[model samples]
Target: MANTTTTTPNAAQDTLVLIGRALIAYLFIPAGIGKLMGFAGTVGYINSVGLPLPEVGAAIAILVELVLGIALLVGFKTRWTAIAMAIFTVAAALFFHKYWSAPDAMKMMQQINFNKNIAIAGGLLALSAFGPGRFSIDKK
Candidate 1:
């Protein structure tokens, strides 16, 4: 008699991947919503960084964080979304969380945020390489 097992070894892995995606999305979705709600403030913050075209920067950030974040949460185009998010996270860390140049009073917090962004980016890159697990829309 042949064994008939429907469950794959990847069940746990898929659950973990889904959870990871949700966690990552949780970080960005609210942030994107906050930015959208406070568009003027977001633009002001971008301008404070002396980046050119602050409004454009804010718009792009909103699109990436909100749209791609949703895509990631749902496991849609997971690999590409993860890659884009990784790039965006790194860029944000460099531009907004520049700990090296931060004032002494703010240095520690800035460093923490910068490191967090880098870690998130690393996770995203890993997700991109591994692909979304069996639970993801990409797999289905």
Candidate 2:
């Protein structure tokens, strides 16, 4: 006589956490590389937005995307990294992606950036509150 049981909640949650990490990693890798290689004209674009410290902001953004992307991918300090990223995301959306009252063409681009930032920010917010689960460095 044998009995079968479903996976525990922790196991399911662990899998979900891994998926979330993967999602963030995939999204950020290109961004990190772009910043690292000065591709996509992101640095110049940041400055054009009238940011107070374009170089410093660009450097910080690169570091966050690289370091935090790696941390999230490996599930290390998941909550903390996620929280920092979430705040960063919101700040970026608010500052550069301001859609309201923007010109038609600019509005389209701002809308796109704004939407994507909000979505990614939501995921990071979830990670901040829910944690990375047992399949992470923080767990060990």
Q: lDDT tens digits, residues 44-65, model 1?
A: 9999999999999999999889
Could you tell me which residue pairs clash in candidate 1?
A: none
Q: Give the per-residue lDDT digits (tens) of candidate 2, residues 7-115.
A: 5557877898898798888888778888879844766888788887777888888878888999998888888899899888889899888999689879988999999
Q: Which stretch of 10 consecutive residues in model 2 shows the poorest summed lDDT? A: 1-10
Give each model's whole-structure lDDT: 0.94, 0.86
Those runs of model 2 whose alpha carbons end farther than 4 Å from true positions after fitting are 1-8
RMSD of 2: 6.0
TM-score on alpha carbons, each prediction: 0.93, 0.86
Which residue pairs collide, candidate 2? none
Clashes of 2: 0
